[model samples]
Target: MHRLITVALAVALGLGAGSQAAVPFYDTYQLQCRANFGAAFNLPAGSFFTSSTPAINNAGQVAVNLVNVNVPGNPPGVWFGQGGTGQVKFVAADSNATIGSISLNHLGRAVFPQNFTSPNGVYFYDAPSDTSGLLTTQPIGASSFGTPIVNDLGQVGYRVSFLGSNAWVSFAGAPPVAFHAVEAALDAASPYSFLFTPSFNNSRQIAGKVRLGAAGQTGENRPDQIRIINPDGTFTIIAHDRDSDPNSLFLSFDNSVALTDNGWVAFNANLFPAGRGVFFSNGVETRTIAVNTAGIVSTIESFGPAASASGLVAFRAFENNTALRAIWIGDGTTLRRVVREHDIVPTDLGPARIDQHDASPVFGGSITINRYGDVAFNAALTPPDNNQIEWGSGIFVALARTPGDVDCDGDVDFDDIDAFVAALSGPAAYAAQYPDCRWLNADCDGDGDVDFDDIDPFVALIGS
Candidate 1:
């Protein structure tokens, strides 16, 4: 089975030309299922669900706002749980509030926004303390602050109301740093650009949306933006609504942007003459990794990108006007679909293999990818019923595998040999292209580095 998949990758990736860009073969690992999600709740019979916006840290620790509802209860309260095994542990609870977002850092701690509650505001959860604390309790009022994100250094950043965002850093002995409003830095450039949907990285960088005009503008004039706030207080407007920069030709930068530890920001943008697509920038050069079915730029969702420090990017895309949807991954140079609608996937039902997937239409859907090449996402499973189709929503995780599977088609063929040679000659060049990735695949001998020792292993891989 592995050999066949490898061959498919080699042929599909156009490896005969020895392109360095590669597609990856992923080993899918089912971490939890609908039963697992329901198991987290101690509800009556069948009331179960977590917030659609789930988070996964680098250590594979997934944090979910498990919604535990009871029969005839006032409202559902969001519970927090972690890890793959065992029932979920207890966390904070709040009725009359629907959490817009929850983000987990490397330490498993999280900061999120809660709207529709008394003193509506954002809160923080610390695993070490096993307690939830307040970042700000003042009413969020509107869904202005997209989602609050946290870093390992106890630095949390989020938008406040509709004005802008602020970063709150915690110090042990001193009073928490006064909210360092990044918007204050942004207003210097674009006057009254209401910032929303701020994301954070360990490097103290934040990327988010900045509304160009006043509130209540909903049309071609509606607000849309993409901005990156550096730690040094300098800000860059990647794209915005009605932007007229002839060089890039972007009609509008969508509302969501994902940030990684090294400051790589990925966002979906609508481009003039190019359509919509996912773009990644390191505050330097920007590249549109994926385009539409006609090779035109496009994106599946508004906030549709999840990135990792290992240079792996996960996103969803589809044809311009079709139900054919696909989830894709980009390994710096090449972008390839991991799964698609109507694609057959093996199931444990013994004789039944489900091939169709149901698409989710919710904004800010929980899609994630880690540095280790593991992808966590939520999609609906479509199985044929009696002349009908039944949909079952599920959360999944896939691990990237197959070394030398450049162009990640899963095959290690002659194309890999040439690509590997180029990578070996100057790994720095390749690393520069994939700053978040450390493609150590050339270490065929199982040694740490891709050095001379890997030559024999490379030969064996080909001979096999």
Candidate 2:
């Protein structure tokens, strides 16, 4: 069987040059919830997701924040759901307290902050145990806490603000530690302060943006810099606005930063004098993933870019000329458009147009991408009926097509052999033969291509 498969793969490669049809890159788009419509708890009338970014873990579990607009104070709540599953469940809600943004871990645990209960601070919800509890409160002398994120080890990192100073604190089953504080000196000449909300990775490293002056300094005097605080209390500066190297220079950085376990820092910033772009660096080398230019992106949104452990970065931006907002994924060399404003997507409720009204920075819905390249986001939808714009907001997920599932049956098996060959023949031929499946399913190595390098992995998956 292996010999025959190898021969078939060779022949398919020989035929690759014959076709050039476009193939779909993703396998599914799942709608977890829509305004007035959800598989779990029914949202209050006129409820919409607040300006909190959605979070997704490697396990494909997603958590998002919700707000009831009809309510006088716009009370908040948190909702949880899984990819490919239509069900969404209410994790927690408080009519009297406003819930902060949330972060999910591979263990299906979520962390957020709220003041509704006593000892108001960051809280955790364990999906497996179906229980919730307070993870930690404000550190001693800290007046408030915000932007809490949980890593796979269940450790929580957040920003703590005092009377006039701010610090980034991390908690691991003990009293939180302020790893970095405002007005701290990055070096002899750079008295960097004012840390932004940070991204935490399993390596115990926290990455964030900092201004290069005292806390209250504004404008160009306090230029932005990206730094990663290591586990041993040491830190590395990845990029600086004042760097003499033209490649590392930037006018300013967005407040958000994403850190991967491998130490890549992903962010978006304004280019000096003109243009904006998304970038990722390893503290030694910086790479531009996408930039604003004619016929390409016109404006890259300032909401921090999301980075996966595998080094892929995802961000929201506006397409050039058209000014259409879109969610994009890149691997530092190639970019793929995930979804765009006004694009009609298939939903369980039927086809709906992706309305950008609620996806703005003011409305929340920042993009989140996992290691598997799955992107989670919130958007307002216009149903096929074209009515009911008020009940249009929804949380949606785009599931990346799994490698080797060439037949698109949600699995890899013996039946996929012929379809796999067709996919290798070229996207055009593959689409002609299997119009419903993605040619990318043949990318068993997940290198963003269908080629001979995938044959061995494909065989192993079926053989196992």
> Top model by lDDT, which number?
2
Worst 10 residues of 1 by lDDT: 349-358
Per residue, candidate 2 scores C-alpha lDDT tens digits across 309-410 of 666788888877667788888766657788777777776567877764344431245888776677888776666555345335667778776666677654
lDDT of 1: 0.55
CA displacement after TM-score superposition, residue 102 of candidate 2 (Å)? 0.6
As a whole number from 0 to 100, the lDDT of residue 256 in candidate 2 is 90
Each candidate's lDDT (Cα)?
A: 0.55, 0.71
Regions of model 2 farther than 4 Å from truth: 3-24, 37-46, 69-75, 84-94, 176-178, 184-190, 218-220, 243-248, 356-363, 385-388, 402-440, 443-464
Question: What TM-score does each of the candidates earn?
Answer: 0.68, 0.78
Runs in model 1 deviating more than 4 A are: 1-23, 35-51, 71-83, 90-93, 128-130, 133-146, 162-190, 213-225, 239-244, 293-299, 319-323, 342-364, 382-391, 402-464
Task: For model 2, name the residue pairs that clash.
Answer: 51-364
> With candidate 2 superimposed using the best TM-score fit, by how many Å does residue 109's alpha carbon deviate from the native?
0.5
Cα displacement (Å) at residue 210, model 2:
1.0
